[model samples]
Target: MVALAKEKQKELVEAEKYVSEVYEAIKERNPHEVEFIQAVKEIFDSLVPVLAKHPKYIEHNILERIVDPERFISFRVSWVDDQGKVQVNRGYRVQFNSAIGPYKGGLRFHPSVTPSIIKFLGFEQIFKNSLTGQSIGGAKGGSDFDPKGKSDGEIMRFSQSFMAELGKYIGPDVDVPAGDIGVGAREIGYMFGQYKKMKGAYEAGVLTGKGVSFGGSLARTEATGYGLVYFVDEMLKHKGLSFKDQTVVVSGSGNVSIYAIEKAHELGATVVACSDSNGYIYDKEGIDLDTVKRLKEENSLRISEYVEEHPHAEYKEGCSEIWSIPCDIALPCATQNEIGEPSAKLLVANGVKAVGEGANMPSTLEAIDTFLENDVLFGPAKAANAGGVAVSSFEMAQNSSRVSWTFEEVDAKLKETMASIFTNSIKEAEEHGVPGNLVIGANIAGFKKVADAMIDQGVI
Candidate 1:
């Protein structure tokens, strides 16, 4: 195992050397983007065979340019609260690539927002978008503002102020941003309204995840969650198992967790646990979707509220303990690094057959190593969470055509895309003699398409 890891590390180093010239050229401009650069390098290293097979990409220096964004926009968002206090936050928009089409990605608003996080997300978006076989390029933007306890009015003012500066660089053709993390339908509405008011015209395509009354597609809210289940279903089918009768635990009480729970229940799985940052609630009986949704969306209450309402449920104080519960399937729908090596060991010891990431990089490097070493079926974040961006790309298509797709139509498309992504990743991994290494498969498959496009376009 140590020898195998060394081999993988060596391959990664070689891949970095292959793109070192491009990395050095952009290093100055992209200072503090080491995480983003590291992820790109790791994926690029795994694609050495693909690059060798497709020499045209090398002939055109696609590897060099694809690692760098086409444009990066930074601006300040200042807003006045209802208390008459002025607040300031930093905002970012990283337009990673536009070789396939206009930039398309989500805007993540959270207290943790930083250029490095946005760049990592945008970098991942490049491959996730490509895996869908769509024409959308990759971009991501957001602010450092936290909307947790903020009043609707306060959030509205902040979103408007943020858009006032962001409007200058984004458009349907140039770039498009949607909702992510702290940015939801409400935030999107505020930003969209501000963009229209500033431009003196209405362009629904400018932002996605909008309300249906505006331009949002049906199933957009549930796309990420449903797509997650669909991908897991495919993975299970490959192993001759299914979601039926499986006890599942999911983290996060937001959109992803809510719908993930709903779909898991629908698929005949008992979702035993779900959580939020403040704590987690577990019930022997499956969690009720309607009750969980109301507590989270309507009351803005924590998971503890659910425990209060359901006497049978138990609420744990810390968020990390959610992984300690025994389950057949575990979905990490929360933030990055929420699941570490110890938590991974607990899941493996308790008989977790598969672990799918519903959030971006929810597992740490050690956790991933533990899962891989245990031969646990693991779905990496890039492939698992690609559902959200895939639907956003679909929304972009609907907006471009000036038409909205029915929920059934959009949902069918999303399922098909997720299945295709799973198949492609598995196929690529098998080709590289790493049959279940979806992390490598996802990186290679996603990188090949974008790299080819970059090569075809030539030298930025």
Candidate 2:
């Protein structure tokens, strides 16, 4: 018994040391990529036990290969602004992995976009795509071109110029890109138009998030938000709880938050709060989704305007302070690292029962630790917010078949996919002796599939 105990202790130490070495190597290679390092460390930390259970991954150097992107394409995009002045911006497409299928991800067009941000998003996509049971691998592309105040013509010119170069690298079966933070229908339309003009063919599958009349999937806009709620609903149900009578706080007034608010209402929950970059609005009577849509999507205004219409509701000044409002659930739909350790602790104190990430890497590592340690039903972004890419893949299918499904059909499929993801995550968690730990469960489930595929393909 003493010998067995000593051997087990040695194994645990070895596993921890192995993962630490891999993580240190990653930091050394990408010395300045803090966000990318954070993402890698989070996923690697969960894989220690898995590595001990299956030494084959180590034998094949799967960790090393997966960390390094298969391809990183960067280019300069020069376009004529509305002022007739030529503006130049950096553009990138990191085809991180393609073992399962072709590269698949979104194209973010925000000023904060950098190589580190794109790399982090792409790395997360590898597993997010895997958990969906789809044949798509992982990739992410974007630019530092802020679309905030750009005119329609300026955006069109920028999109065209961006695609003129990006088109050389993507194809229907090669890689697919969709709308992300700043790239919406208008931007997608411009890019798709350019791609069509350059190829002299209508290859709709080359891109998702196209205008519905063109090739985009119905309910694509609502996929991420609604899927988030669906996944959370499952989580709540498993604990003999439901969304009924729950007060929810969802950050962001973008598509994800809006649709999430919609679905939560449908599920019998009152989403009292939603926010934008400037501030957040807390409506005790439940958020007015339609008014928010008009303010954000149509009028292009700040979230503070929500209070102008709803007199009873309060408008807070800080965006991060949304977590302090207290609720049964908290969905961070805004941006990366929005929820820090302090904010997470506040939520726990306020009695937040569940947290489903609608945005990628919204919570910092410490914040995530806080939630899990408190026994909060925390749904990691990769598993919780994968609905967008899953629906994007559905759009790819529709384009390939040259047929579009109805709204109800696509929505029903999204719900089913979300449920399956939940089931698989929990099953993997239980199997790995980390029952109820969705973070470990999701990471393991996603990593196993991709690792097996990479090993079979013989390390390209």
Candidate 3:
């Protein structure tokens, strides 16, 4: 018994040592990429148990290969603004991994688009795509082009110019880019038109978020939000609870949050609050999804406008205060690191029961630890927000087959995909002897698939 105990201790020590060495190497290489380092650290920390179980991953140097992107493309984007002045911006694409399938991800156009943020998103995409059980690898591209307050012509020009350079590196089979942040249906339409014009062929499969009139899937717009609720509903169901009669808070009035609010309402939950970059709106009578859509989508107004239409609702000036609105569930659909440790503790204090991340890495590592320590039913972004990409893959199939499905058909597929992801996450967690811990379960489940594919492909 003494000898066995010593052997187990030695194995654990070796695992911890391997994780620390690789983490330090990653930080040394990416000194200024704080978000990338955080993401890599989170995944690596979760994989220590997996490393002890499967030493072959270390033998094959998978950690080193996976952390390093296959190609990092950065370029200058110059376009003429409405004033005839030349506006310059930087664009980037990080094709992180392709062992599973073609490079697939979204192109974000927020001012926050840095190489660090893009790399962090791309790195997380690897596992997120893997969890979908679809034939799509991980990649992310974008520019620091803020579209707010920009005219239609200006956005069109910028999207076209951005794609003129980005188009060189992407295709249906090479890499497919979709909408994110400031990039949406209108922006995607402009970019797709440019790609079509440049190639002189209608390659509808090259982009995922094109207008439904072209080749976009029916439920693609609602996939991530609806998928988030679906996955969380499963978590709640596991605890013998449901979204029925639950009060919820969703941050962000964008596509993801809007649809998440819609779905939560459908599931008999009242979503009392949603936010924008400027501030958040709390409507105790439940957020009017149509009013939010009209304000954000059609009129392009701030979330504060919701109160003008509904006098009873209150608008808070800060975005982070949205977390302070007590509720049964909290969904952060806005951006990365939006929820810090303090906000997480506040949610816990308010008797928050669940947290489903609707955005990529929305919660910090410390915040996640707080939720876990408090026994909150936490749904990580990769597994919960994968509905969008899953539907994107479905759109790819439709484009290839030259047929489109009804909204019901696509939505059914998305719900099933979310349920499957939840099941796989828990099953993998239990198998790894960490039952009910979806974070470690999801990381391991997604990592194993990519790592095995890399091993079979023989060290590219």
10 residues in a row with least lDDT, candidate 2 = 7-16
Backbone clashes in model 3, listed as residue pairs: none
Query: Which clashing pairs does model 2 show?
Result: none
Cα displacement (Å) at residue 190, model 3: 1.0
* Candidate 3: tens digits of C-alpha lDDT, residues 185-266: 9999999999999999999999998899999899899999999999999999998999999999999999999999999999
Query: What's the residue-level lDDT of 90 in candidate 2?
Result: 96
Q: After superposition, how far is residue 134 of candidate 1 from its true place, in Å?
A: 0.9
Q: How many clashes does each candidate structure show, in the order listed?
A: 0, 0, 0
Per-residue lDDT tens digits for candidate 2, residues 1-460, read 9998797677767777878888899999999999999999999988876887787888888898999999999999999987789899999999999999999999999989999999999999999999999999999999999999989999999999999999999998999999999999999999999999999999989999999999899999999999999999999999999999999999999999999999999989999999999899999999999999999989999999988999999998989889989899999999999999999999999999999999999999999999999999999999999999999999998998999999999999999999999999999889877999999899999999999999999967
What C-alpha lDDT do the candidate models reach, one value each? 0.86, 0.94, 0.94
Instruction: Write model 1 residue lDDT over 168-244, tens digit each, in one string.
Output: 99998888899999899999999999999999998989999999888888898998888888898889999999999
Task: Kindly report which residue stretches of model 3 are placed more than 4 angstroms away from their true locations once superposed.
Answer: 1-5
Number of the top lDDT candidate: 3
Judge candidate 1 against the unseen true structure and give its global Cα lDDT, from 0 to 1. Answer: 0.86
* Model 2 backbone overlap count: 0
